[model samples]
Target: MRIGLYPGTFDPVTHGHIDIIRRACTLVDRLVIGVAINRDKGPMFSLEERLAMVEAECRYLSEATGTEIVAHPFENLLIDCARDVGAQMIVRGLRAVADFEYEFQMVGMNRTLDPEIETVFLMADAQHQAIASKLVKEIARLGGDISHFVTPTVARSLMDKLGRG
Candidate 1:
């Protein structure tokens, strides 16, 4: 069975993220969603909060898509997380040219670290092309509606974190 890994900070798990996760699942037998604990970014949500939101959001995916989807929290090395999950390919989503440039560099470094693993890029669905976690958080913090960007649980979590709920 082919396994794939989708690694991201997923600070609050945006709809765009769920879009990528669903798209990635169609290509692999199992897809592991790695929530990176990159503390350097000073994430608005804690690791536990991020993981919980991802878990809550993804719980129905396996049954809905007939593709096993699991969310796990990881730290530091992404290649290590991929290896641990037995993933043969790292799945990435490309929203714009900027995303491509950044991901291209990361994919190259990941390939250099593990020659056997490959990377696959998918274009984000047009409807969600502009949704990003950072922007969602900013909107929520500034009293703007972000109900359209993330899941209900994530929306509430973001509001709670920003002291708006």
Candidate 2:
């Protein structure tokens, strides 16, 4: 089976992320959404919350796309996570050239860590290219409407968590 690892903090899984997930599913037989435990980011949502949201969002993707997409939380190095999940490739979403610079270095390092593993970059949909989790959280915190950027469930959760609701 061709398994791909799409790892991210996914603090609130924005539409941009959903876009990447949908697109990535087309390239792999099995896609594992690895939610990283990056405490450094001081996530608005807990790991469990983030995982739950991702699970709910991606629940139908497997059935619809014919790709088994599962969400897993990992604290180890991404390469280690890939190995643990038997992922042959790592899927990343690039919103702009700025994303390429960072992702380019990341893939290079990942390749060094595990030469057998490969990384594939998928461009974000034009409409979603500007949607980012950080920006979404900031917008929600400031009482901005995020319904357009995220699913209704996530939008409500963000508002409740940020005291904007």
Each prediction's Cα RMSD? 1.1, 0.9
TM for candidate 2 is: 0.97
Residue 14 displacement in candidate 1 (angstroms): 0.6
Worst lDDT 10-window in candidate 1: 156-165
Candidate 1 TM-score versus the reference: 0.95
* TM-scores for every candidate against the unseen true structure: 0.95, 0.97
Q: What's the lDDT for candidate 1? A: 0.88
Model 2, 99-138: lDDT tens digits are: 9999999988999999999999999999999999999998
Error of 1 at 121 (Å): 0.5
Candidate 2 runs further than 4 Å off: none
lDDT: which candidate is best? 2
List model 1 lDDT by residue over 14-90, tens digit each: 88989989888799999998999897899988888888888888878777888888888888598999999999999
